[model samples]
Target chain A: MKFMSNKTLKMSKVLLSAVLSVGIIASLSGCGSNESAKNSATPPADSAGSNLIVSQTNPIVIDKEAKTVKVYTEVNGKYFVEPTRHGVVFKDGSNGSKSVLKAWGNQNDFYNGLVDIGAKPGNNLKLDSVGVAVEGDPLDVSITWAGAGKEIPFGDGILDSTKKGFDFRFGGNQENAKAKNTGCILCLDSCPVGITSNAAHPTKDFDNKIAEFKGNQEVLPADGTPVVVTFKLK
Target chain B: MNTKQRKWLNVLGSGLLGFNFGFVAALLLAQWTWLELRVNTGLAILVGVGIGLGIGLLRTIKRPLAVESISLLAMLISLLGIGDAQISSLKILTGYTIREGLLMPDISLQVANLIFSLLTLGSILSAIVLKRKISG
Candidate 1:
């Protein structure tokens, strides 16, 4: 009986040690296996339907004293203020006006009006500054674009002289000029400029000539700035 | 061997077996459909109870009190092992901290706790009431 009991005690110790060793090995092995699985399973950053615009440059500058919003883009080795689409809506508490400026081509095409300097279109139409001369401190301001979608919220509407306007670049390096243009439709509702107004307001209407153009809409270009929208509250 | 030493050996063997079973069950639950991994309270409780009942039936203890105690201990040990495995799997698979994974509104930890408690109670009761087979 004594010999049998001694053997039993030895067996118990062996079993306990075996169980502990297996548990330790299992726990440590899990971390390494999990790491490898995670690396292999992650998906690409820009798989279809992922609306990621990769722009590294700041493009919009707001001049409060000058009451002007300036938008700039790199075109043909030069910085130009010409955007494929630009619009500004100005309201003072009660009423407002919405003005839309668009270049010729499908709304989704990014390179519609791009031309050389001293080109036939002239500088007046190519300039990036949209002037809104309104009286009584035009308390509310909303800006929109045709080729870009809403990527960030435009914080409170109040703009100070020191405040710089919002800047965004579309379609990073792969400048597919034919990328679909999903327009920003909530710019006014997201603006923090004026007191919350519930009254129905006028919407900016696109130019019939440009809107009617039945051209092949190409993807945005892969290099340089394709689409940029900047809002400067003055 | 003495009764105390034999009882302790039985407990240790049963507890370790229960832990291993629980860990594998948790891993299987984690690798199930994505939604199951996110909210596997029902599965965890079921696994805990099953392990406890299985371990209890395999032990030689016949007294109701001893059976209940062993089963309860095994259940607690297994549940703890399962919880650890679940947290590790969530971190490895989803890159989410255990807190982040469990804090989602849809995957309530409170619900899991309730299920675990109720199942553990049922398992303890079953162990005490179930008859053990007699071997000549």
Candidate 2:
């Protein structure tokens, strides 16, 4: 390195910095400010008499005819909160880093959407500081992804996560709750609309830090791809 | 070159190098998920110090204080850049609301960014303090 003059070193450093800056700027360009609030989402004008229950501001549609609740979502990436685990999280929630799908809708609205389709709200799981499922009844619900030609159960897209699909419970309304967002739309751990475990069998309890549950990369699309998630009663 | 000219050159060069190195590290921390999630805080700090040491070892130094001062300034700028990039990356991936995301970041991301920025400063400081042995 001493053989090279100071001028050469400066030039090289400049080139390297420029290269890195461009790459990061490109990635940054892909992202836009979150304006979901400013532009309220409205349902299609054609569906006046149809059995479609749509949110005025959120991207949730309750289909009473199909006996299902549909939510708009995008792939968060194969590696979210954990190495292998890929859970579903609310778009407005803080746990997007740990979830595979980012659902763009209100959690409360999702809950009501389920109710509209005759799905009963089950007891929500409560966890200790260590994140163990101490209490809560599992709701009778089934989650699926039909973005592909055929309908695929949520368990199929996941790898080594669970045996009994996804055991979910309606984590009741949190209208006045002081948490980041009221009502849990869908989570891996204990919440009103969360699943039993993000991991299949943890050494101790259901912790989000564990990298046990992985998304099957072959089955799922790449990150940032938009898709629909459906919820139905068992 | 005169002594004064040499000193100024050394200071400016070190500061620029430090800023670029820190920016590169931030980009890596933002893009790579494994590094961000798996690497612990202590290890991250060590890595930062190591980068600083490497920068110091590369240069021929006479006046260390001037270089150190500039390096510190560079560290601050790098810290801001890293924080903004990390937040923007999270917002894009998660679609978080402006209130909860840009303004109020997740505790986990905050911890991660803090560690990364610390590493940037460590590298800059180490580089300035590290002396290249004069080869006869």
What does DockQ come to for candidate 2? 0.07
Each model's TM-score, in the order given?
0.22, 0.49
* Residue range A156-202, candidate 1, lDDT tens digits: 22121223332221111112211222221112211112111111121
lDDT of candidate 2 over B1-136, digit per residue (tens)? 5645544445444544444444434433543544432332123323443464465456546534334444444433443453454644342322221112223333223233343334334434433333221111
Second chain alone, TM-score for each candidate: 0.35, 0.31
Q: Which candidate is the best by TM-score?
A: 2
Interface RMSD of each: 21.0, 10.0
User: Best lDDT goes to which candidate?
Assistant: 2
Q: Is the docking of candidate 2 incorrect, acceptable, medium or high quality?
A: incorrect
lDDT of 1 by residue, B1-136 (tens): 5656555544543443343345335544543333331253224423543564466457754443343444334433543454454533222222111112233322222232233333334433333333222111
- For model 2, residues A180-208, the per-residue Cα lDDT tens digits are 45223655544433432322232233334
Name model 1 segments beyond 4 Å from true.
A1-234, B34-38, B41-46, B61-136
